[model samples]
Target: MKKTLLAVTSLSLLAACSSTQTVEQAQQFAPCTFPDSPTSEAPAWVCDVIPTDLAAGALGYAKKSAAGIGVMRKVAVNDARVQLAAQFQTDVSNMFKQAVESSVNTSTEQGAIENVVETFESVTKNVVSRSLTDSKLIVSQVSPAGGLYVLVGMDKQAYQANINEVVDAASQEQKLWHQFNGEKATEDLTNALNSLKAM
Candidate 1:
């Protein structure tokens, strides 16, 4: 009888633990409500979470502009473009750092690494500027206070094309790669290009 009672107690404790964990996970993923929403009912997109279907997305807002709704929308769209560009720059920078660190020896001068990073950043900014023109306005909403929220996204195909441009830029940067040599440098560069394309 005692053995059966102990088994039941363990099962009950396990069930309680599982339920608690599930609740915590749900809370973690709860959508953020947009501030100053015009109505209690706002679309899921307004929650500021980028939709999974988009390759890249950003949220932008503009307070009531003296110009007009069209101006407000343009301002908001531009803001989102800047944000998306920054995000892409950050992602590429991180990947570049990872690839270089994994392959390059620690003795490589810090200044050289920094120069390469700067070059990549400059190239990324230019690429993003050209590519973001292709992004579509996914949604727009106006708050009761006249603030406008705009969401913009780049489709996967367009995003991939931009990635290719960046990779090509990297490849053409002969001076940047001249610092390293051998089959390993070539292999790491190839790997980095592949990862960028995947992104």
Candidate 2:
């Protein structure tokens, strides 16, 4: 059986870092940097996510769409499965950018607020049952832009929540993304993480 690309706990570390740049520093905010096939394709379960130009009014995505592509690519990427981990970052980054654009466009100053998609992968169920021993959780927040992101990832040692608790922590009622995917037809990060397996 094929494996699920994301473990989730690894993503727990994703935190809401207050803007390092000042309001004046961000004067040169350029979002439309990474440009690719506004139309994208992938596997079946998470495949049909081609975006229908969400770049219309208050929620436009051209600028941030480009930046998201760049940031996600610039992340430190390394995996034995990838012939050259560096190259893989670019390939995977492009795919992720496409997924983001297909799901949510950079139409607003807030960026693609939040996105989550899921696919039934033939992963070892045990993968979700572990935790990174020394991992810690912090942060609790509520925002108008809906900028909550929960990332779960597990390394060989243990499991961990990818996004910081303060940002997208699992609350008393529901898991992060699981709870986020409600009645709305919004972008899904679960689907993006599902395809993280580089090989």
Candidate 3:
């Protein structure tokens, strides 16, 4: 009776471990799927599978409403612009942080770096909003539920230009420039731009 009990306990533990491992593996390998529109299939872009030739893209949607398609397009486009701006701000912040941390010299004061980051955080939103005027609606779809979806993107060249403009503007901030090695920081930040494209 004791031997049987031990064997059953061991089997239960083994089965639990195996099931847990299988669940983890399934989650890791699960395929990406976009939510289908009521009337149409969702495009790959809706899942953020950007094309190789584009630097960045965003997906936006508006729920079914009494508003016409024009209103829907405007709402979706604005939503996409908001998303794209947020993404750009985050990417730029990461690039700046990497530049400061990975620089050959770390003599800049920590307080100064924090201040610069704060300044950039505020300025980046406005800059990105203006830059997004250049972004175009690549495709759009209407769901069976009468909602609208839009994919907004900027080409690689235009996206690069926007990055350069943002960096250049940041470098021009007199207070930030006076706080640290502005030229060196700007150069490192520029070098990091290539990584964004690859991502």
RMSD list, candidates in order: 5.4, 26.0, 5.3
Per-residue lDDT of model 1, residues 123-151, tens digit only:
77776767654677999988777888999
Q: Between the candidate structures 1 and 3, which one is better when assessed by lDDT?
A: 1
Best by lDDT: 1
- Candidate 2 vs 3: which has more lDDT: 3
Query: CA lDDT of each candidate?
Result: 0.75, 0.27, 0.71
Clashing residue pairs found in predicted model 1: none
* Ranking, lDDT, top scorer first: 1, 3, 2
Which candidate leads in TM-score?
A: 1
lDDT of 3 at 69: 92
Off by over 4 Å in 1: 1-32, 37-41, 101-118, 130-133
